[model samples]
Target: MSELGLPLSEQSLQQAHNGSREEVMRVFDEQHFGRHHAKRSVAQLEEELQKAYKNFILANEYKSSKLCEALYTRCEDKMDQLQVLRLPSMAKFNAGFLLCNRSFEEECVGPSKTIYEQRMKKMLGKSRSLFIKEYNHRLFNWLVAFSLVMVVMGRFVIKFILLEIGAWVLFIFLETYTRMFWSAESLYYNPGWHFIVAIWETLVYSPIIDLDRWAILIGVMLVILVLYWRCYGRRKHGGSWLLPLYRNHEGGSNRWRSD
Candidate 1:
């Protein structure tokens, strides 16, 4: 797509050249739009644009004018004029929010930078963050509604034996996913499932299975092993691959270095 500097087939290129606003909106997701509090940032907007363009191509398995229209429609204003384009969440965040370098309006306009800036200011408020907040708030509310629907459907789907088997598999997956998810941010607030697994192992697989205190000792040893590995890796590797620190200094420092 032109916005994202992606290559398109001849047919796709032709469609983009003549694509309608609605065609573009359907492909736009939350990340394609800026953060709720930071819409004015061009970098965020462009990142979203590039992501939208790629996702659109991928999702449709090719370009269709119809798909493009749907993408455009997502970002269109209440008056039916295209406001800001949307990007899929995957596309949006992968493009990196904080790394965005263009103005919000500039990113939205894409190739037509000057025209979009003039039109955008005329149509929307100037505060990028305010625009982002409102957009994201609306999106968040939509997600909550969608989640409720899925929960209801999930309950229905879990009633049968086949579905129950599927559900059990899903439950296992959810456990693994939840552990990874919660452990990434706040392990304390996370439910004790991981610890429960640890405890279960300690009780079942250790001393009981071995008929000695070795299991208890093994659990303690495993904990120490993990702790040591983490500490050692951080100190020796000088990379944040395993123990990824959400560092404010890294973001700010990178920006400062560029300046």
Candidate 2:
């Protein structure tokens, strides 16, 4: 047995092959749970296992059919043990190995493809959940800050408009940065990132005003209309400021008008 407690060399593997199944299993147990093995970190163990697996594959590439079959079985069994160890990195590595080596005749392509797909799905789900949680937290904080700014400087119309434009630009930059940072592995694309990019392009590059600017313009118009109405009504009527503009003021009585 090598330092890792597994038969990694051709001579060692041949010796293990001659030995009984119980002996082979005993070696596997030692590699997995032996006292000396406990001193090594999980990362060390995984690295060793990965190296040994590659060596085994290379060594058995042109060997006899029977020997290749035997070594392949050992390799598969070792990977299964690694799975039981619950190391996600190793599990992903194993899945990739299986998928990549599906032409080895030891396993069917269907099963390897299925395992790879399952692993990818799980990884995508985890990434998406984390991305959403982080995004919501950041968005909530941003909205709170924006609200406070509006409350504090709402009387300064020009400054408020500039702030709105700045806020929109900053929001887009941060959102794009966040999406790109969270979208893992170039091999797989996140659907959320694509969707966000599509919407952004459509909104920003359109002939009409961008959505954020349009919203700001509409809001400013509404504020102006309300102010005009209040001032005009106050000047036209001598009634109390708190009274409605439609209140009857034909005589000296403050009453509702039918019209």
Best by TM-score: 2
Clash count, one per candidate? 35, 0
RMSD after Cα superposition, model 2: 21.0
Question: How far off is residue 225 in model 1, in Å?
Answer: 49
Error of 2 at 190 (Å): 29
**Candidate 2: deviation at residue 251, Å?**
38
The ten-residue window of minimal lDDT in model 1 covers 87-96
How good is model 1 by TM-score?
0.20
Clashes of 1: 35
Error in Å for residue 222 of model 1: 45
Give all TM-scores, in the order shown.
0.20, 0.22
Residue 55 local lDDT, model 1: 65
RMSD to the true structure for each prediction, in A, is 29.8, 21.0
As a whole number from 0 to 100, the lDDT of residue 169 in candidate 2 is 55
